[model samples]
Target: MKRFLLHLLFWAVYLLQDSIMQFTWTMSALPGMPDGERIRLAIIATVIIAIPKAIFTYFVVYFVFPRALKYPALRWWLCGETLLVLTALILAHRCLNFYIVGPIIYHNIIRPTSILNLPYLLLTIMDLGFVSGYAFTFKLLRMQLSGKEREKNLLQEKLQTELKFLRNQTHPHFLFNTLNNIYALARKRSDKTAAMILKLSKLLRFMLYESGKGFICISEEIRIIDDYLELQKLRFNERLSIQFHRNIDQEGSLLAPLLLLPFVENAFKHGVSETRFNSFVHIDLQLQNEILQFIIANTTNEDRIQPEQIGLGNVRRQLELMYHDHSLKVTNAAQVFTVQLTLNLQSHAKI
Candidate 1:
């Protein structure tokens, strides 16, 4: 259907140009010639002029421009080719004008033989050169713009596909670890088992449904973090020391779902879990005006730090895709590992 519509539009424009050109010449000759004769000469000129115009356009654009002019090495060849083609086309146009259009116009349409004079022929050729040159330049510009647009669309599609795969990979790895934590509680039959189950349900609900969404409300993402922290608390209880702080300047901001989870998850998996005693995890969120800053730091076992730095790659890529110039830094010092991220939300805030 789209192709059909494009063809329809092309034919419509072509016919319109043909009619306008014929009408213009017919009106210009009306002062000296009868209406019927003037119209006849106009039609003849329009029809015959189309042939050389098409040939000039085709060779200059498709042949000369791409093969010769576009390459520096071929520029000299292009100069020679351009001169040869120009001379040939000008001579052809001159002959057609003198033998065909001029004779018909002189004998039938007008009394002046000046229409076939040298000056008249040169002026006519100059007019043809300007029109053909303008047409070629416009067509080249349109082609270049079209090519760039197609490249942009393809790049966007590839980025989306890569992001989706990363999201899919992240979900299963996170769920597997969380479910194991729940299983350990179920085996011992801890009193907090039911509460842990409720927390797990809410977190999983967000992950399976809301996290898959493109963007979620800022409140929803905060709640997910709150529930996830609570659920992880079940595993360490008295053994884990955790702190969470948040300051929100506005409540209506929106962000890419699941963007912040990997950093927090890394802190737990690497820093808190491996520490045998006196383990600590600190998470802070600060939103001022339009800037959001998140910091997560945890005590590391030092020995197992290298092994547990797993999910950061996927999170880093997601950040680049969603927030163009957002900042993220991770530091490992002695017994503590910290991750900090800052995002600008002024442009992305919802009502």
Candidate 2:
């Protein structure tokens, strides 16, 4: 609407200027037109003449402008096309003057000096007013749009950087704590310490390779979670309880690279590992119809209260950024920590 109004105003200005030009030429050609009565007559006549041409010119410019241009070689093409549009306008003006308005309009009652010959002067001013002005306006609009695109891209890149940094932080925090446990066993020369190292290496490989990317297969995330649970189980021996069930109906479920792993990792990190004896974590991932459902619940020990948001805070940020208003449910109590995240993997985008 604004553009339409602006175009209307632009045409109004051009028509007013064209009328003035005609009035100036007319008064000089015939001195009788300078008197008040004759001047009013010329104004009325000029308005009738220029108004329609101005409205027509506005439509031509608005509808006929082209885009989708790229490359230095194509610059010449645009320049040539622009000239052609202007030249066409000039020819249109001449045709309107010589054929339509001239012969039919100012037939016998109108003096030859009274009707200004717009066609004669149109070619001379075509380059100055028509092509150059329009080309300049087009370049100006293109530059403004380019700035907006640049800002959008910069914002996306910033979010990605923050996400990666957050993921990187989660990796080291998990490893630092795990290595501390392994270090304790290594000092005592425990046999299980070697197995722990191997498990840790596999976890590191996952974090380094697959998890580092923008997205990952859901099956891959589950596998990594299993590896983590198995490693933690070796440390706990048979004292720990775990239930992990996944329905293969959504076999090719796709998600952000490290989406579910962080939640699972957080569950075991704070939930099961807080107190030594008989703690449990329940994990479920399945696809019913087209919806992907993931749930995690872990027993939290009140007596050995851990910081509520160690790994969970960053994971929440990542989830919000990756899947804005999708579907996420989280419940945490003194005794139990739970996360129920539902994502339509069919709607998930490949990064």
Candidate 3:
């Protein structure tokens, strides 16, 4: 709404000034163009000239100017060309108006010799001043808009970073919960529970201290998953099978922190606890054309209910907010769960 008003203001000022200048041109022509008919003709001529000027101004300011500034040579050329065009227009204003309107009025209003008079020059100078002033203000408005746009993007990124930090905190919370379970069992002097706690603690340290960064390497994420699977193996007593299959071309691909763990957590919430025996979790990763692809699937017992309440419902919303339309997919069946995620990784070849 504010943008609409500002646009209206710009058009109003341009149109009002053009109309007033043309009307004044007629009024100032003493023994020249007549009052009524002359004013109408003057307005028509002004409209004809000003319409084209307005179009040119918009194209130059919005399109050409943007490109011009990108190259120093183009920028200098355009500035010089603008000054030349404005100079020619001011000098030709009287000649154009007098030659075009003189015949229609005949000898009654225009004295032919005095048709190109002082009044017209003064009016042209005033009109040019208004145009130049509008151009300067228009450029200033664009500059201010660019600055404000930068600030808006910066603020948005800051908010997202803070939100991501809060979300990442969830991983440590989950780790502590799992560790507490293992610790409880260890207190009972269970040998398996003692080893599970050790593995869990190692994974937790990496997740808490190292992978807390905005992104982590693919190898590091795989290592964390391996450690997590080891901890689960101790807990489940070798009744569950987990496999990691990585066929990606690169080893150090990057991913957002804790993006994959939720899927594994969901797998455990239902796949391990509910399924009586011989459950499986399979994970795969591949990269093609600088796009990272991740796949995770787990078998669940038909009698075991789906873990609908485990994942953060808002995580999907957060991804949409952060990534907009970038690729991410997840599907869950009564006896199987699947998750697929793809990301456009930065590469020099593309640039």
Candidate 4:
């Protein structure tokens, strides 16, 4: 119903414009006729002439244009056919003017010397061409806009799929390492094994429920890291030295879910686990003015240092997909392995 109204509005506007153009010439041609009568004749003539114009416009825009696009090799033939149709429509316009409008407006059945007059035919062609051009241009603009919208939607879907895949990869990698620790403690018959399993259960609960979200509060992420640290502390006991420092202005700031845990997991797997004696892990996190800066350093034995692992690689890809304004740097020097990450969180912050 709305579409029908729009089309009605378009034709009404076209009739008004055509009536105004015809009124000027009509007033001069039928001088001595009353102004009211001249206006009536002009409007009637425009309405009658518009029939052929409307047909030609719709046929070319709806039929010819689509077929031309579908069959590229037949475009020239379509163009020639369109010209013939335009000529027929112009002739029909002349017949309506000669037989109908003349007798109604002039009260005399005056006939032209030849209905095939070249100049008159050309003038009719120009009038019809103007409206057809307008319709075709509108169609082209709508097609272009729709195409761009579809392309944008497809890109968004692709990015979302890739992010879900990367996020899934982190789950098993993290669980594998944590389960190894639990298995080791169980073999030793240590009492900490049950506590470690409980912590692991909590972490799993968060991953299963909360981690699937697009974003989470920074404080929730901090709580997860704290629980993970406690779990690790149970396994290492007094053998590992761990230190964590935080300076945050807004604990409620938003970040992509599970984005930070992989970094901490990588640090433990590669640095703390590979070293035998005198191992330490230090982590510092600062959030000021919607900018997050995270740094983690761990003591490492030179011979035991391994190559880039899956957790770090997955986090790097996630960062690339999620944040446009962020930086990550990794350094391994002497007996220290360090990771530094900075993120601009203003874009993702909740209002």
Candidate 5:
């Protein structure tokens, strides 16, 4: 209904413009006529002439424009056809003005001239072309806007699908590492296996429920990291030294779920688990003024470090997909591997 009203408004404006032009032309041609009679003739002539203009305008905008876009090879043929139809409509407009409107206004039968009066025919064509040009410009603008909207929607959908896929990859990669720890404890018949299983259950519950959300409170993610560290502690005991320091000014800040876990998990998998000697994993997290900074440094035995682990790669892609205003830096030197990530939480807070 709103669209219909807009179209009605456009046509009303066009008619008013045409009527004014006609009134001025008639006033100049018939200077002796009264103002009231001149206005009536202008309005009657405009109304009668608008019929062919409307047909030609709609035909060019709706019919010819779409076919030209769809079939480029037939453009010349379409152009010829359009010219023929336009000529026919111009003749119809001339005949209607001469036979129908002339007698009504002048109260006398008018003599017919050659239907091929080049000057008058050209004037009619110009009149029809004026309105057709407006209609075509409007149609082109609408089509361009609609195309941009569709492209934006498609890009959004593709981003979401890729994010979901990355999350799915993180879930299993995390699970496999934790389950291996549990399996090792089970083989030894260690009493800590049951406690680890309980902690694993809680972590699984969080992953199943909270991880599905696009964003969650920073505190929730901290809690998940705590549970995971405790589960790892049960496996490694005093052999691994783990330190977590947090200086959070805002506990309720929101960020993408499961975004931080992969770094911590990477520290454990490549640092603590691979080392035969004592190893240390230090994590520092700070959130102030909606900016979150996370740094994780861990000891590694290998001389050369491979930072692109599957878990780290997945988290890197997730970060790219979820946060536009975030940066991640990875460094390896002197038997220590480190990952530093900084995020602008406010950018994704509303997502």
Candidate 6:
């Protein structure tokens, strides 16, 4: 339907421009188009020339345009083809003028029948050039816009694949840590081992199923965080001090699943596990007016202030891909490592 409309519009513009050009030339030659005779002649001439012009327009649009845009090296070949076609069209127009219109309507030969009539040939070529030029410009512009759209789609696909890979990377990093916690309990023959395993199962269900979804509610995400923290608390017992503060005004708000977990996991893995004495992990999450602010700080050994950039790096890259305008900052001051992240929840609402 759209192609039909575009073709219709192209022809309409071509015919209008051709008729105006013919009419102007006829009026200028006769000064007044005397008794409607010149007007009739101009109409006949416009109609006769329109056939070859239509042929050139479609030839370029459907055939030449795509090939030329795709293979620029073929442009010289296209130019040669254009010259041959233009010459043939000019010859055909001259034949129509001399054999049919001139002898029948005006009762006189207008020009020589041969293609070598330089002045008549140039005029015919110029008229065809002007009409075809319109189609040429239109088709070229359409091709450029089409190329841009295709490039955009390819880039989007690449980003999606990369994000999927990153998401996959996150899963194992988390599972490994959770499994270590479970292993520690089993090694100690602790009664909490089976219960932690059950928690791990639930966490797996959320990560495997819900996390794959485009977005999940803040409440669901918070539940996952609570589970994770609880599992960690079970492992560290009285040795780990955990302080969690949350002010969630919009529990219905949504964000990418497991998006905030890496930092939390990072703090637990390095802060509590590596430190020998008085280790603490502090987490604060606040959501108000469609903005979510997350802060996590943990006490680590001075040497381990900056942990290996694996899980946190993955999360940072994910944030960049997911949020256009977001803030993530990591600071290491003495033995305390801090992560600050602010996200526009309104952006997720759009998704």
Candidate numbers sorted by lDDT from highest down:
4, 5, 6, 1, 2, 3
Cα TM-score per model: 0.71, 0.62, 0.56, 0.90, 0.90, 0.86
Q: Give one digit per residue, the lDDT tens place, for model 3 in 1-351.
A: 986787678766776667666677557564454677656766666665564355446656665677787886787778787767656666666555566545444333543355446787677667665665687677878899999999988987776775565566567556765776587677878888867867877877887687656667767877777777777767776677888787767777776666566667666765666787668888887876657777888777786546554354444544555454356676768787777877665521110
Local accuracy of candidate 2 as per-residue lDDT tens digits, 1-351: 976777667656755665566666666545654466545555555555454355444434443333323355565666676667656655555555555444554443344332235545554345236634663575468678999989988888888888888888888988887888788788989899989999999988888878867667677887888888877787777877888998967656667776777787777777787766668888888877657788988888877545556577887777667764457777767778888988766564322
TM-score of 5: 0.90
Query: Per-residue alpha-carbon lDDT of model 5 for 184-276, expressed as tens digits?
Result: 999999999999999999999999999998789999999999999999889888888999999999899988898999999999997778776
**lDDT-better candidate, 1 vs 6:** 6
**Residue-by-residue lDDT tens digits, candidate 6, 1-351:** 998898888777767666677667556445644746766776776777688877877787677877888999999999899778877887787787777666665455243556467888788788777777887888778878999999988888888888899989989988998898899899999999988998899999998889989889999989999999888888888988999899999899988899988889999886667788999999999999879999999988867456556898898888878887789888877788899999996664221
Q: Local error of candidate 6 at 3, Å?
A: 3.2
- The model with the greater TM-score, 1 or 2, is 1
CA lDDT of each candidate? 0.75, 0.69, 0.66, 0.87, 0.86, 0.82
Q: Cα miss at 325, model 2 (Å)?
A: 4.9
Q: In model 5, which range of ten residues has the least summed lDDT? A: 106-115
Off by over 4 Å in 6: 27-45, 60-81, 99-119, 348-351
**Candidate 2 accuracy as TM-score:** 0.62
Query: Which stretch of 10 consecutive residues in model 2 shows the poorest summed lDDT?
Result: 107-116
Model 4 lDDT tens row, 1-351:
976786788789989988988888766667888888778878987898899999999999989999999999999999999989987898998887677767765564333446677887888889899999988987888799999989988888888888888888899999999999999999999999999999999999999999998789999999999999999999999999999999999989998888888888887888888888898989999999989999999877787555678998898888877887899999977688899999998654221
Regions more than 4 Å wrong, model 3: 1-132, 143-151, 162-166, 301-326, 347-351
- Give candidate 5's whole-model lDDT: 0.86
Residue pairs in candidate 6 whose N, alpha carbon or C atoms collide under 3 angstroms:
none
The window of 10 residues in a row where model 3 has the poorest summed lDDT is 342-351
Error of 1 at 349 (Å): 13
The positional error of residue 125 in candidate 2, measured at the CA in angstroms, is: 7.5
